[model samples]
Target: MTNRVEYLRSPTAIRERCNELFELAQADQLPYFRVDLTQLDAVADYVIAVIREHYPDLDVPFHSRWRHFEVGNIPRVRQLEQAIESRSKIEQAKAKFDLVIPSVLLDAGAGDCWKYHEATTQKTWARSEGLAIASFDAFCQGAFSKHPYQADATALKQITPEQIGAFFQVGSENPLVGLEGRSALLQKLGQTIEQSPDLFGDVPRPGNLVNYLIGHADQGQLSAVVVLNAVLIGLGEIWSGRLSIEGVNLGDVWKHSSLSGDQLIPFHKLSQWLTYSLLEPLQDLGLKIIDLDQMTGLPEYRNGGLCLDLGLLQLKDPKLAEIPHAADSELIVEWRALTVCLLDRIAATIRKKLGLTPESLPLVKVLQGGTWTAGRKIAAALRPGGTPPIQISSDGTVF
Candidate 1:
């Protein structure tokens, strides 16, 4: 019974299968894309420069949702703590979990034209940072709450499109990309948490996961993979119309032509992202999460776009850039999978050059000091609006 289904459950599964496809593409056996190892060193050089430029002493934090909360140099999370000073540390951490889960889920493409002005910070924000600030503001305003008092898990379980859209300023004149899809995903996430009282608890708060992790933690330690697995399993029902096997909803896992037995390549990009985001919160709870690199590099737009923009991943058809593609298309999946594989290779070179161990400069740091920034920088130089090299019709959940 614990056969292929188990393989589809972990972040490691995503790494293994993506590695396989990467190798096949290297041998020119896979269609839709080709791997260019020659440009990898150049890619490495650019990322290293970006890393050194920002973090001169190389004190890079793990890339996560926490970074976005501080947009415009505002310590939004710290502010949240100050506002909720009466709560216990555990309660605060749980509140953070509640905010982070939906905030991360709400993070998709905001499109080019839309922008957010943080009224408190007095700074204009756009894209991910804008979304993060807006979500944080909404959380503070009790958008996720059923009562007017405070943010709660059960409240998050009953979120709506109007709440999401109004906070993010979505309207006919100011439209957001994937607005409906984004709203539906968060609404479903609420439902999933409500049903999973065992994991999420009776009130089913997202922060209840912090308590679950604390219980499963061995000698005050928890596995990073377990956190991701919990997110994938607890919220599996959130992602609709994706691949499923044996009656289990494989959240973010997809099919590919690379294998037949279980071509299900799991790229729990957002889940892994949430796992990274929870690092500091769990640390605040006095729990240590080990095996950071086991989660793998995210295979989303920025990292994947770095590969395409750098010429490390060449489209088989040059004209394909002009077309709108579904997120699950063969070409897009291949690109996402390859981005996962290549980020590992690139991280190795970055660590080697910096004379740092994986513990010091994990893939998470490399991504933060790392590839995603480099990709966006390059995309800005190569294309107008700094759009990704390939267009993906992302539902709010996946990206």
Candidate 2:
């Protein structure tokens, strides 16, 4: 018999489990918290205001890690384009795939204090943008490449902790959260790539994923969820100590008691975030990735914090927000699962208020417009450190 945990291995499982939890919450069956669906309108208003302010014409882009790189009006991608101008468009796509896969993997929470100084911009970036730039610079310097002279994919298949640690500035005074785990994760990434010759080729370049998508595309069409599944299957082993069932590693899937059957709930937040990031690159190759809404909202702290900050979700004890919780704690599991359901509700309200259809105002744009930003805004307003309402212990692998 197939292992039950295997169901939680896909994007479908994440959505289904989240929806099941939402229905339970709606019926007041969840014990950790109570959700007031009526309160979502206020949250919607706040997000709508933010969206209009940032995107005046409502022309919002998909929410992805790429946006962090374009911070401060920096043409980061254009700079990359100029650097790789010698390669054909297809090869450029591969190079970008190579660059982005590892970059996105390295993008866990950087805590509040650590900052990156961009020598070129002469500015300091504190959070995600800093990490993105730092990772990009490392990639440009060929940090992921082993030979630095090889023409093929094997170059990226030789990353090491020594190289990644120094490049990320993981040291005593400048501590990065989960530095050890993060370093180990990258080294394992190189190993994972090298082992998958059919998918990654002899050298195991991240860009080779572009070829897989292109070749498997159904009549020039692909689903965003399909991209997410590819990421989960390709890099599942890179995440150390994640859930595995029947010898298959279930990356980013967790267990929650509120739901039954497999007893495993999936939330591949980072992988889905990676899928969202891949949209532009694949589109650059002239492939249309349809069914954007099929991908659920990311269940990270920023989005979950927004619910608590906005009073949409209320903890039973109220003091739970201040306590440190493990990544797998039932409290956080509920919070994260609830965030997924609430995001869909929030998007529905915003779309109705804006007089737009899901076709026009997809959840991607809704997120970019202001849901995540509003979460950050509210956090900074309510908390001193701008941390999430509930603290999570990150292993540099899971957020």
Candidate 3:
């Protein structure tokens, strides 16, 4: 058996293999994408099995339904519903969360090249090499201070101290995948921005989110895959910006690249969707938003709809709810890799269904229309089924 395990940790290897898979997918080779679906399904089944095996008593947080809970004697979800009932507030929160939180989660040292409102804060913090958690925490603190929080002591007291402090933990702050928590904090920050635009600015600057992702990925002279997920998922580009990579401009390079001259996939549409998902709270705060159709989705999900339903991605086993599951070496690698492979499966399905040639196919398009949409759909689907699996953890970062 070729050990498929190593691919998750290695960026260079991942990019390389992804290219290889892309080629295979272009040829409509089913084995390239579907070979491991059964295995992945088994893996997911096994994870649940393992949880049941080891901790039969563990209650997984897979509350995929809706229920009301009070926090600070106020209903958080209800507050959100009330806010977005208005039209203008909806626009503001969306743009702000989309543009702001992604940049806020990057390491303090790297987001500097991009000229943002508080780029100086990023430049000043200067994260230590390989210190993602600490760096992320510092970024959150700065961003939070800049967010719309109550200036008055009464409101401050009403706020959960744990929630407030959770915003500053630099390393993985998410309740689930613990590997350098990224998404949850961004999500939280987005919600905060949505709820309190009076404090945080509306509208994430064009490309600021992307710049932060790229720059943070390159920091310490090494790329972190977890960080990459944070960047791509939270702040991907709606349109490819003209930029130099390895002495070649992206626009020119893209032409010669496999996806060039292909029907524009509107990959940014998926990205825009995800950006919208992340930024909806910000939208509630009275900021203007860019058009949702502007961004593309990540290759992780292709052909739209629910990613969880399509079996491409699965949430962390709710049974391991409190264990900081992302830090589990075996589990994290298995889940992320499974997700990646499934995403490719979605692309392969699209290629075959659409009759598009590989070189000219809108790979980014499929990602936006297909898989990314699925992930968001699944996320939305989970809202009404049970108590959503999202746990309020005390990590300074939000997913």
Candidate 4:
């Protein structure tokens, strides 16, 4: 059971198990979604156009949370670097982790109604951009620390839903979805950090993870999977009411009826997203991030919606789009697994069309210059407000 739990947490398991579903999808054995290989060319064409539009030179960064921070052509990240200019590179890296960890945790989908008015930019932003800017502002104001630029366990433990609501500008007029769940997740983060002193440090800050990774690095280099393992081991307990094996909480993992025996499938979506977000900070410290392709494409709404919107995936019942699905529902799980599988196919086709290798255009870069933006573009054209084709009931944790 312990080994099984550990296996479920791995990228290897994600790809292997999801591929099993993909094969089932190919055989038309799955109950909910149908695989349409005929539409894959069209999907790749659309993604290539988006990549050319966004990056004419084809130089794309990883599809991390940092991109959202740069919304509206602003150099918010550069501004952050300037603010901490006096700090050493390691400290700066820590500060970036401090800011990004919480920001990513709070990054589950903000419903269509919520919008944030940024006082600094005097700009009204919605969706992921709005959430990113709001969290950025809160971090700058020291909402999670006594000091203005760090996230300490002490401060995070005391964070309340009202405080989170206030920092996010949530009110009767402006309601951020899953406000309480967001707050509870942060508080749990604090508790997790406090308990794992070996990972966090004596003072207990999320930034302290910088030291842990640095210690774990093999001569100034680290594998992305190691970083993901640390993230899952250190913070897996923060997820609420999740499946557990041998008392180990399986964060972002779910069940699918198509599987044999255990019938369990792991997406680890937010955890992998957090891992992707953490890499830049490590890179800033001059550590080479090896095996970047080992990280799977995130199975969130944007990537998943792309498959549905492009007809690469067709729901057996179109009415599934008309209602909200729980994050753990079998249909949603199948949809996410297929998204992960199809994204690989899409990435391979995209590379062939662009005359590039996986090394030149890794899945992460494909996500950035490629599929995610394409998904949003198609969604906006098909639906009002650019909403995903499938509606998910969020708790400010899972997407």
- Scored against the true structure, residue 254 in model 2 reaches a CA lDDT of 80
TM-score of each: 0.96, 0.95, 0.31, 0.98
- The CA lDDT at 154 in model 2 is 44
Assess candidate 4 and give its TM-score to the true structure. 0.98
lDDT of every predicted structure (CA atoms): 0.84, 0.81, 0.32, 0.92
lDDT of 1 by residue, 301-324 (tens): 899999888888999998998887
Candidate 2 per-residue lDDT, tens place, 191-244, comes to: 776677767777577777787788778998988877877787788888777777
Runs in model 3 deviating more than 4 A are 1-11, 15-98, 101-308, 311-324, 327-329, 357-363, 378-399
Query: Can you rank all candidates by TM-score, best first?
Result: 4, 1, 2, 3
User: Positional deviation of 308 in candidate 1, in angstroms?
Assistant: 1.3
Question: Whose lDDT is higher: candidate 2's or candidate 3's?
Answer: 2
- lDDT order of candidates, top first: 4, 1, 2, 3
Minimum summed lDDT over a 10-residue window in model 1 is located at: 147-156
Once model 4 is optimally superposed onto the true structure by TM-score, how far is the C-alpha of residue 272 displaced, in angstroms? 0.8
Question: Which candidate number maximizes lDDT?
Answer: 4
lDDT string for model 4 (245-349, tens) is 978999988889899768889989989888999999999888998888888999989999999998999999999899999998988999999999999999999
